[model samples]
Target: MTHATELTVIHVPVSDPRVRPLLQELGDEYSRRYGKDAHGEISRYPDEEFTASHGGVLLLLLEHGEPVAGGAFRRYDATTAELKRIWTHSAHRRRGLARRVVTELEREATARGYRRIHLTTGPRQPEARGLYLATGYTPLFDTEADPETIGPLPFEKHLPATATHRATHRGKAAQP
Candidate 1:
């Protein structure tokens, strides 16, 4: 196995301006590659939406102080959470940053009492599908009609009960 320096992942508050630019870049790249309108969809959710409701947590991953990935989790119900806005910069692809981001998000979801996590991605995003599958996410029913649906795949992952307690304690210890 190849051993690289351990990457540091930090949570970016929804209020950060860096989030918009990173998200815009992710959308623009997706649209350019897939021949669809993705930037508009990403712009629909603003900082205010995340702050106003206790609906979810948005995080940006920085490598050596440069933002490389972003993802969020929105509560669907008491036991379920939806992973949204998952994206990694083109420059940062194939480095396993996406998988790390998803794992962190899953840990966060568990800490918030979420027992299951779900997400949907367009068929054009093959890399994303692979990451989800590799990370233990299973295919689920697709209920919405997506514009870029090469059959947009829906996935779900169940969280073990101990995941939340462990993450919560770890987070508390990490805090100054």
Candidate 2:
């Protein structure tokens, strides 16, 4: 097992070559679970959507210079960052890597001036559902309903407003 100290986090554009392996494996995993090509979903958003200049970022956790886990978030609204493409390599599962990825994304989003986060995991992805829940995300849908009937399970987390965020909203009416 790799120790946490051995892992390194780096931000890169979604188009980086190192990102390809993660995407390919993630696409294959999604295809197997949903019985359809999910590569389209992977590419649904334009490449620029995950660039830093656009209020978005993609991060990968690498060990020994090889990508082991990764995730990304795009600007959902002025105050919300929408997480997408969170994945841990199949061989690297059960190691708490996804949680690390999520934590890192949240930190990055907060630094980028976002006060909330929105994300959806496919109904077929129970592990993802658990991960978000364990990480303090509230489900936006009824958890008791059958997952298949629910389709994509939406979850959200309101980040602790940074000093910048608090200052920006100091005298303004709180947005609902």
Candidate achieving the largest lDDT: 2
lDDT by residue for model 2 (28-118), tens: 9999999999999899999999998888999999999999999999988888899999999998898999999999999998877788999
Q: Give lDDT per model, in order.
A: 0.72, 0.91
Provide the lowest-lDDT 10-residue window in model 2: 167-176
Number of residue pairs clashing in candidate 1, backbone atoms closer than 3 angstroms, sequence gap of 3 or more or interchain: 0
Error of 2 at 69 (Å): 0.2
Question: How far does residue 74 in candidate 2 sit from its true spot (Å)?
Answer: 0.2
> For each candidate, how many residue pairs have backbone atoms clashing (under 3 Å)?
0, 0
Model 1, 80-155: lDDT tens per residue? 7888888777777777777878988888877666678888887767787778889999877443444254366889
Off by over 4 Å in 1: 1-6, 46-53, 141-150, 163-176
Reference-based TM-score of each model: 0.77, 0.94
Q: Considering every candidate listed, which one attains the maximal TM-score?
A: 2
- Which residue pairs does candidate 2 place in steric collision? none
